[model samples]
Target chain A: MLTSNRRLVVYGIAGALAIGSGAAFAQGAVAAQYRWLTFAVFAAIICVTMYVTYLAAKRVKSASDFYTAGGGVSGLQNGWAIAGDYLSAASFLGIAGLISQYGYDGFMYSVGWLVAYITVLLVIAEPCRNIGKYTLPDILAYRNNPKAMRIVGAISVVTVSTFYLTAQMVGGGVLVKTLIGIDYEISVMAVGVLMLAYVLFGGMVATTWVQIIKAVLLVIASLVLVMLVWTPYGFSLPAFLADVVGDTKVQAKVAGLLGDAAKNMTPQELGQRFLEPGLYFKAPIDQISLGMALVFGTAGLPHILMRFFTVPTAQQARKSVVWAMAIIGGFYVLTLFLGFGAAKEVGPGVIASIDAGGNMAGPLLAQHLGGGPDSFLGNFMLAFVSAVAFATIVAVVAGLVLASASAIAHDLYVGVYHGGDIVPPQQQVRAARIATVIVGAVSISIGIAAKGQNVAHLVALAFAVAASANFPCVLLTMYWRRCNTGGIVLGMVVGTVAAVGLTLVSPNLTYPKAVRAASQKVLDGEAAKRSAIEAALASGDAAAIEKATVDQKALDKAVTKAKDDMKKVEGKEVSIMGLEEPLFKLKNPGIISIPLGFLAVLLGALLFRDKRSEELWPEVYARQNTGILASKATSH
Target chain B: MATAPKIDWNAVIADPRFQALHRRKQGFLTGLMIFSVVFYFLLPIGAAYFQDLFKTKVWGVVNFGILFALLQFVVAWGVAIYYSRVANRDFDRMAREIAADYEKGG
Candidate 1:
């Protein structure tokens, strides 16, 4: 390992060089009034995290140290880190926006996310800690053909991480651009470089600390907003919720968003509708499908699973998960108040007008709570929240980079290429740092290329693949005695193919141009009819005028019907085949792909018998349960 | 880089204490796993089929659905805290003893 002093000098020079170049490149004149405050907050966050990374860099000595902080992370610390790693900008902002706009459905949407940890806590966390070492493939390759298992494991981890990373990168850039007027490409590069620095120098220690800091900041920021919103109702949740569902102003504002759909409903009816489930999701199956994905998919996410290895023992792993559950569960619960609070105070129409997706609801609510945007307090709160959001995205992306890098360097480079035998630890750590750079570069490129595209579906796609592909194999490898190397490979391949294939043919792929043309046709036809009616009325003959009045009434009704149809079609997606409707109806593939994955594993095990794998079952079982031969904490 | 010491894993697996610890942990985990899974899925199922039932107000503006959904967070924390306690109290003790047996014998 490099001496701490030498490493410090190298990192200092690199940091100085980066700061100089970043200042030169980010000199674009941003128009926001509070741009200076935002930049200051951003700089402060970076400096603190980099300092933490510098300290962590001194401790990273071996491959294990680089990957798992030498297994020295306490249960509480790792628990907070997992929360930091798990709650991306999506959960913090996206879910809040959903609830703010969609009402009760949005709150319901968050329940599954919290409950997902039950899977992680009950089924996966302790066993994962007892079984795996550096990467997830460690568990799979233990009793099987190590080479094939490692190769497949690396591929799956990289694939899942890449999808997840792209979403975060794009979201980070877009969020920064919207909040502080930074250029999207520049912001993406900045996020990539900062994440690379964390993993390259600090490794898991830096990444974990970064996550902990971000998670704490995020919760504090959210708590502030929730408290501000609830203060009006004397901090009573029931009173706040009562106003959300009973207030005439809130009901009217939300009902107006539904347009003609709520025309006949009374204010009380609309208030009740606001707290009902069907307001956002027309189909219940979509909710159920997404729920399945979140609940199962969380257990299989490589980044989340990697957290367990940071703890010393299975019991610590279990305790860390419990801590994570409390924090995560509490955060999701707070989202209920935040979402409804925004709807109550900021108004859904106002939130939607700012960002159609409501991604800015949290920040916007912060601004509204402080005052209006014109006030200094409002702008300051906005800047603070925007900074926290930036930290959130960076922390998540850093974790993603570490996960993919470990999979590549630990599983593929060391395990597969070197046959898990003679690779030196320092060289392995070097390979991991190199892998981090490559993963960061690739994700940055993908994020830039995918700029301005609707990438919301990629998040769902990532979860679905994790749930279907990785989860089944990992679950079976531990629980099923008959599961073998052939079974794992087949299960991963089949599950990945099924999930991706279903998404490809599903309504996720839509012909926007054609939909626009169809809507234009309706508008144009209506315009022609309107001119004809005008001409008839202008002729000033009593008979023709009377006839024109009747036709005008009919035309008005038809126009309203046509406009509503167009509105519905605008949100609905079509398959890439140019079909008006998708062959596959469900947006998420978890309900279908998960079972197919399990079935494929069964089929593969029955077809290809591996005596060696069968013979190792006792050892694997004993170790996974009792932690007899499981990898121990690395020595300094 | 020390390799793990070799021991008779089959014998360890056959040890009565090891077997009992495994059995109890698995039984408890399986039961909790089933309960949590079933309890969790009820959210979507209730939302999908029994909309009115879920909408029945329990308190001021807090409907059965919202209450039920919020209850999930409690249940999750309860499951996690409860499981961790049982695992530490009953399971971890037994596992340490079994591991100690092997450490000495090997």
Candidate 2:
């Protein structure tokens, strides 16, 4: 009875928040481009990973092996897996796509994932390793009231997992659809089946190896990209950047993001402005919201926290973070080169020609740098990158499924449902396999349903949930003795509700403006004239198509009329569920939800005042502090 | 009957070696975090308010924001490397010494 309320309230709020953004993206703008070579390369990568799964499955025996790879993974190896799981397609493609299109705003996206490791290093990882054997719930249950702790922990884990998994799947499906001519539904399900097979059979052991392989391939890809981008300019970054300064073409290309204000500026001034601040984060609140979410959210992600348990000891867990930071930091530096190089070399016009959404910025940049479209270099590089991207998505999804499945089997089924420690390891492992399939199926459905949504935005919402629901509970448990079971439970619920609630009402998730149809523009003879030009292009001089221009007065009048209507509706206070205008002004909910998460923890601890939480504190504290529990270490 | 581990958290906290380890980890982390937070905020805050300052070129063709953003990666790597060194030489050694002391009932 207590458990059901936790799951219902948390998932309910999160589900509602996701629906609005998912619906807005349903009208995806990117056209699918089928490349058979990309398909063959993708198939080869799949074959290798499936073979790895077979090897891992042969060794799997117990639940301990299922969740943590028997705690035998070395520091650097676990570090590689962490990097693999952490750097999803969002980092590889989304960052490049965004950077090539948006410039400085795009590079800021990668900084968070890099800086997030600091939080993981100094704060969460060691204590997590010391206390939790398998799931986030294990740490939460270390103190008072295992039932209460398990309920909220399970809820928080599943909520984070589902949102994060849906994001990876969405990116996987859409990018695959765009690169190869596969349908989005088929691509999503293909990813789902691969993820399910890995977790259900290979479990954590195979998942770790797959992550390590993907991470290595991705880093190598990033390095090669940096070299390719620089090779055109005699490998001199300064020469390339300076060369971009006076180019009227590159300046005009970035003009849309710079706004109409830049139209009067000289080309040099325009170039300088692109490198200056405020391309993306123009507001102080938006910047802070982004920072808070990235830093706190990374600390709270269930898969990342679970990675610490794979290492033998707390010390190695700490070392793994440093390794992740090194890889991530270097990767972001290379991304800077890619983003600026794409701006100077590929240009926005070329980027738009490939994909309107800029999702192809990285892959297309690789192809362009290799050679023009018709060349073997271009075609081959594109296929190679597509394979790496598909691998990136698979590794991320496998991790998500594993994390979510553990939350279900280890936390919910064994810890809560079957009663803790009474259920055998054998039974729990089987339950986890079942849970993986169910989670995989649901994620695939959401991915297909949410196809065309912006990858970075979907991911930011997931971070907001993690920052709000998970960070506070985990931090308080590590530091504060006063933190009660009720405190964490209340914190998780409040944080989830607040983050989801604020996100739903945020301006970022607003329904895109309705297009005033072209049928209405026929009154000015514009549509008729355009059709005439199109007909001429088919039978007459192709250059004659250049004579087509819409009647400016009629178009301007339509634009003004639409703007006035939106202007009037902008500040109007509507009901909570109304979609016409957002209730919250900020694009991100982190600035509000993070503090609320902490507030709920404080309030609940003070209000509920469970003596049991206080009593068990020293024992949990002792273990966490010195790494000793019940006459021995917990695990490696 | 299974025997529980004999533990004394108060003694551990009081141990000089433990205190040194704690002090080192906490101090380095606190300084690093503050430096990171302040340094990170400077990019955005400068970008938001002092746009003109970041627009000025310090080296070659790169503007101030570019240098500042690039420096973020360097500082992150430097801090991590520094932490790792301190952990291997000082903190880990202290941890082992404290554990040995507790085991010997010293």
Candidate 3:
């Protein structure tokens, strides 16, 4: 009777939330077509995912089984799952949008991401699997002070996970709103509930299989879509280029888009920008930076790394990574076509009209080429794509929650509470599930708060955090024996602060008004006046234009003052010399903050090296041997 | 002088079955790794560069390359499983052989 009462309460709450969500959906002016499919797909995916989780739970008999899938998952399966996890909506949608806007510079993301895996395979992969029990803190604490490592690891996990979770939630909302006529908040809540259910019930086993299925589907769908695109265009690279070059509007847009990239360009460079077909080959440095963030960030991601641990043996790890690389690489190549095809077929005007956020290009393409939104194929594709996007968010969120749960359960709670004595497997698993619900709730709150923010941009902030705080400590601990807990902790703190602090203050985070105001004061006074004049001209109010010119000198002076203030705040030279200077100086500093994190770790290690044991050799040797052996076995 | 604690030499190397199993596992994993490398790096580059010869548009060639890459991934997975089974068998055999040799004390 008590159990039934509890069940009733649970169902009642769920029913209320669903009802509320439906009301919100109706009020938000969502298209009915988008709503039905999204709801159906969301329900279907959640059900299937939960069933998979149930199977995993049934199989769980030990801590090892729950935490690492008993290290028995095949390498190939783990690899696909890893790729699935790594290739988020941000990568698929965001990169495509970036390419549509930026051109060749966009491919830099592909290079950065692919090459970072090389570093992972060589340096981090085997060692991480061998030494770390669950979370990164496990490995760090193994050699140093547990108390400090736990605190730092928790901070790192929470910080990265928070940003990642928020971005994914935003993505989920966008997916719902875009595909299934629903309110953004309701979509976010729906995704949150679905993810919470999966993590709480199924755990890592469900997470892995879900990721694998999604990865396969994403790859296959992309391939088919790319073929559809080429069939119309005749598949000739040079011919495609010629057609693109022939479009004067495209050339003008490309030139406009390149902005600063054109400043120091040779004729050939300028010509190439106008001539390029897909913007896969030529773009500006900022675009390059964005790409680097995507690519290099992949290796440093905690969620992706955790997937490797689920597979048994170093050999399996190796196999999984190889498979992941193949799938991910192939998927990226297909995205190029998708991006270009969208540009060709849907046209940029439609994209600009749908959402200025630029993340809707791929779905919009599916709608146009497959058939309009009302067509069977089109609606199905829309639902499928949106579902995939939602699935991507759920899969990533599950990984984040799991990582946080592990950090709490394995590192903090177990390490502190049990003093390394093995906790009962069932108890530990229960603790992890509880942790998942807690994390899920917190993430949902954050997602609701960060309404309407660009999901991709938010994800980049997570990457910046990961690159700054976690990457440094992980790398130093693995390679440098001199690194002590104090150094690792301090370095992580410093890195996290620098990256997060800078990101918060940067133009990306600040409101557009603040950015414009800040920029005006930093540049020259005359330039500021010129901008005001231009604004007046654009508005085409002759009376306002004449009046604006009378105070133009004053406005110019204010602009200069603003520019100077911005320069002072930014700690870089601001010149009226060109618009590019302020933007470049402003942008580079944020990204540059990431490397400072690496330096902090190095400094910390150097300073604290003597305090640690002289014979750190034994532990280091053990870890290295295990890593190498695992790698060799997996690589075989 | 006291001999170094009698090393378990017989226990270390006596199991031919274990070696065979280990070798099979190694072979399988190695094959998979090779496939992954080719699929990810070599094939994409080849297709991109030689799209004209493939008689497909560049994009089509790239798509084909991806298909091949997916295939390679499957192959790599198969090899990994084969390797794990063989390697575990070999390790077991080797351990048994070593124990037997130690017991015989030849």
Q: Judged by TM-score, which candidate is best?
A: 1
Task: Please write out the lDDT profile of model 3 over residues A274-317, one tens digit for every residue.
Answer: 32323443323444444445434555677777776777565566
TM-score of chain A of 2: 0.85
CA lDDT, every prediction? 0.82, 0.74, 0.61
- lDDT per residue for candidate 1 within A1-636, as digits (tens), equals 447544653565466436424543232212355677776776777788888887888888789889998888999999999999989899989999998888888888888888888889888988888878878898889787789899988899988888899989998888777666667887788788778878888999999999999999889988888888887889877788777777654575565568678888887778777787767777778778888888889998999999999998888898898888888888998898888888877777566655668887888888888887788888778888888898899899999999999999999888878888888878988999899989989999998999987688888989999998899988888878899999999999998999888887776765554556766776788877789789999999986686567567655755665676577567655545656656688898889998898899899988998887798888788877887755443434
Q: How well is candidate 2 docked (DockQ)?
A: 0.51
lDDT of 1 at A3: 70
- Residue A61 in candidate 3 has what lDDT? 57
The CA lDDT at A102 in model 3 is: 47
Return the top candidate by lDDT: 1
Task: Return the candidate ranking by TM-score, descending.
Answer: 1, 2, 3
- The two-chain DockQ for each candidate, comma-separated, is 0.70, 0.51, 0.06
RMSD of each: 6.4, 7.7, 9.9
Query: What TM-score would every model get versus the actual structure?
Result: 0.90, 0.86, 0.72
Worst 10 residues of 1 chain A by lDDT: A23-32
Best by DockQ: 1
Answer with 1 or 2, whichever has the higher TM-score.
Answer: 1
